[model samples]
Target: MTSSPDTQPIVVGIDPDPTQWLALAWAVDEATRRRLPLRLAHAREAPPSKYRTAELTPAWETWDEALRTLGTRALEQVEAFVRDRRPEVEVSVLLVEGDAASVLRGQA
Candidate 1:
């Protein structure tokens, strides 16, 4: 869905890495200055595995859980970082499941 008139539109790429913190900081500052909303997104890659379909059933579930947890943590950290720096800025978090490049492209 598209953003509403009241909704601000500033999208930023986020990761568990420290480098993302710099980008997030910049995006948060810009969003705050422009009175826009900030969208922090993290893309997860689910690559095909060598395991057989039957063997992958349980493994897939475990892997999916791990990825979800990691994504949640990353989003939480980024959100906290933004709030700590710019508490008044509006921020939203997104966790997209797919290849990083493709997910980012789709969002754009």
Candidate 2:
């Protein structure tokens, strides 16, 4: 019997580095075989700033926007990669705002 939608998800950590693509591909195949939903996650850490205590300076805002854009692009790339390789598998994208290990641990 297939697992229900509320079952534990098959999570794949993705990044801008090409090496992570291999892990994603493998996860996609496993998820498809198991008939489980795939969650593609990309975590981004904020950069250090001198105005961090300034309550939102223009520089901080710009940096934040850049980080968000990077996360978006990474997720989109992985989503496309998964779709091309395993179109039948259910997939979801997660753009997390924190360190990779912490984000993954929280998901677990």
Give the per-residue lDDT of model 1 (tens digit) for 25-108.
Answer: 889899878888888889877867666388679888888889999999999999999889988887888998888777767766
Tens-place lDDT digits, model 2, residues 8-54: 87988887877758888889999988989888888888665565867
State each model's CA lDDT, in order: 0.82, 0.83
Stretches > 4 Å off in candidate 2: 1-3, 48-51
Measured by lDDT, the strongest candidate is 2
Q: Count the backbone clashes (under 3 Å) in each candidate.
A: 1, 0
Clashes of 2: 0
Clashing pairs in 1: 8-37
Model 2, TM vs. native = 0.86
